[model samples]
Target chain A: MKELSLNILDIAQNSITAEADLVEITLNETETELELSIKDNGYGMSPEFLASVHDPFSTTRTTRKVGLGIPLLKLAAEQTGGHIELTSVQRSVDPENCGTEIKAFFRKDHLDFTPIGDIVSTVTTLIQGFPEVDYVFTHRICEAGSEKLVALDTREMRIILGDDVPLSDPMVLMWVRQTLEEQYAG
Target chain B: MKSLEELAKIRERMQNKVILREGQASTRVAVGMATCGIAAGARPVLNAFVEEVAKQNLSDKVTVSQTGCIGMCRFEPIVEVFEGDNERVTYVKVTPEMAKEIVEKHLKGGKPIAEYTIGAAEK
Candidate 1:
């Protein structure tokens, strides 16, 4: 992917497809490194399926023969002198502790590091697309000895909006965009 | 820091208005958003539709959502518009600019842009 945000969107969709109610995307960035982690309390994968996820041919979709989401992310991370780790516990195996977590570490100073572009839009798009699902997005930046954190939790929004107003409501989405933008600005 | 208090105000304001039930919109816009679609730049197209739908104030009548791969990887960034029960139009290789036009000409004006449809691309 040209942008890390696109990769995030792609990987996050896998969690959505797995019927996850809560997905957490966290970005922990320092001066020289960035760690992107997406964790989901979804169906997760069997050990067999998790083993094949690195292969381009391993896919759950019936539409085509290729699944590039994970592979592409792995490549992107490797290109930046970084690596990725994927761990999952199948729901059938452990119904209580079943989920998947994918963590990618990228070297920010590497020549091939893809920029994290327009993440605010990526997040808003996810909420708009899957309003029923709860998302917790936290971007923590540690640079020049000062740390900043930007975060949003849909569960909190749901508490405020109740069952009547959906998170997908245009007004709510607009507020989300504005709120995130304000956080990034300050 | 931005707070949830603002969201509370929005909810209070929207509580009086009628909320549309899911799948109740007369017009539905579905954007392909699988791995292929995202790799092909569907995010911007999807966002464009969301923005245009809200910008045109058609949120009441029109709903925009995402779909997985339709086995049309080559013609990705595909967008499909559905009207009523059976009428479906698929547009291929859509850009954000074209998404705006789609909302205006098709969703609002009730005319599918023939030139942008999959049928046109096949020719």
Candidate 2:
């Protein structure tokens, strides 16, 4: 992907397609490392499927013959003297409760590492495009001894909007996008 | 920063049109956005469809969404239109400009541009 946000967007879309009801994304950047994690409350994959998820040739999409999300992330993390891990429970037994977690780490100082893109774009796109699902995004930047946190929770928003008002409304969308951007920017 | 006042205006105007569900839509404009598709620049093409649908005021009738790989990585920026019980129209290697044309022609005018279809490309 062009940006880290795009990769986040890609993986989150994967969760949605897998019938996830809730998807959580967290990015933690410290002095020496950038750690990224995405978790979803959705039907999980089979062991056989999980084994091949990182294979660029094992994609399930009918529009194309290859999958790069897993492989690319793994490569990105490793290239920076870091690593990635994924775990998921079987989906059939507990589709709603079963889920997967993908975590990747990268050296913050790696020259070849991608920059975190406009995360606001990624979060807004997911929340607006799929209003039925709950999305939580957490961004933490750790430098020196202090940590700055910015978070967005769409589930909390649903309580306020109720069933009648959709969060995708133009005004709400504008707010969601800008609020996250401003927080991170500052 | 933009004022929240304008948001209130938008919310008022939207009424309940903001969140579009598939069942409520009559036409589905799907952009292929698998890894291969994204590598080939499907994002802009997909965004173009969404924006054009709104600009044309066809949001009520058309849903611009995405689908994973269609197994046609060679045709990375492929787009498909599905309506009624008719067969789908697959457009291969589409650009933003072509997306706009598809909106104007197929989505709005009820005619598929055959020249842009995969069949045409194959020929």
Candidate 3:
């Protein structure tokens, strides 16, 4: 699977691109438990889209026949004793929240988002937002049994990290490298 | 464990450079990212571009993004270069190492590496 952060970023970005109004990113860590939830309020998925979102063979558009985003998220979750789940609803939900959701898992040590040295980026570009489709994101890095939460706003992200922060950072790169070596090593 | 206030500092620093409008149209690099592409190791190729572009401080001039695929399975992990009024330049079979050349040669030097393009694959 792509670095955990990229998967989250991908799903969130897709939601916004589809005219979603709100995207949520959450990272939950426990003594031995880690989970990620990326949800969006966009157009929601058609039944057809939902069925195919997890399939490696499905095509997102005529130009492309497959998407590795979800597949990568699934792979990452299973590796660390977790998995990926997707749910979507049409107009039943608000466009701002799109009613699209993806959840993934990882072990305490197996998780990484680019900034922490994994091969993924914690920052996702809502390229299709603002003037085109005004949107907001609620990004949280949390821990179980701990009330403390780190909420990040899109505007503020570009500031502290500098506009140059690659979606994948050294922290994320290290995480991906270590996980791959651990799983594939002989 | 970083806090939200820290993010405000980031926003304040970048307030002047942040543009909220679309269609301003910055240079963009799209990397193929289908299952086949990933299996063929496109992730590293994409990461290389992201890393190299940022290292060069060219983020403002180039937007590095990923798309599912570009329809050539046999030659997966393709990178398509787009700039002002220029025809699309497709580079096939890329690696992280090759990405460095693209950044230096094509992106900065204004010359597509025809040797590594699909046109080369056709022959």
Over A87-132, each residue of candidate 1 has an lDDT whose tens digit, in order, gives 9988998888899999999999999999999999889989999999
Please give the fraction of native interface contacts (Cα pairs under 8 Å between A and B) kept by each candidate.
0.80, 0.20, 0.17
**What is the lDDT, from 0 to 100, of the residue A56 in candidate 1?**
97
- Could you say which candidate leads in DockQ? 1
Candidate 3 regions exceeding 4 Å error are A47-53, A57-59, A64-68, A75-83, A92-97, A106-151, A155-186, B1-28, B33-66, B83-86, B121-123
**Candidate models: Cα lDDT each:** 0.92, 0.80, 0.61
Instruction: Specify the poorest-scoring 10-residue window by lDDT in model 1 chain B.
Output: B16-25
Model 3 chain A poorest ten-residue lDDT run: A124-133
Q: Is candidate 1 or candidate 2 better by TM-score?
A: 1
Please say which candidate is ahead in TM-score: 2 or 3.
2
What's the TM-score, to 2 decimals, of chain B in model 3? 0.85
Q: Estimate how well candidate 2 is docked, as a DockQ score.
A: 0.27
DockQ ranking, best first: 1, 3, 2
Q: Which has the higher lDDT value, candidate number 1 or candidate number 2?
A: 1
The residue-by-residue lDDT of candidate 2 on A1-186, one tens digit each, is 667777777888889888888999999999888999999988888888888898898876654567788888888788888888998986887754699899999897988787777677677667656778899889899999988888888876676565666776444766787777777677
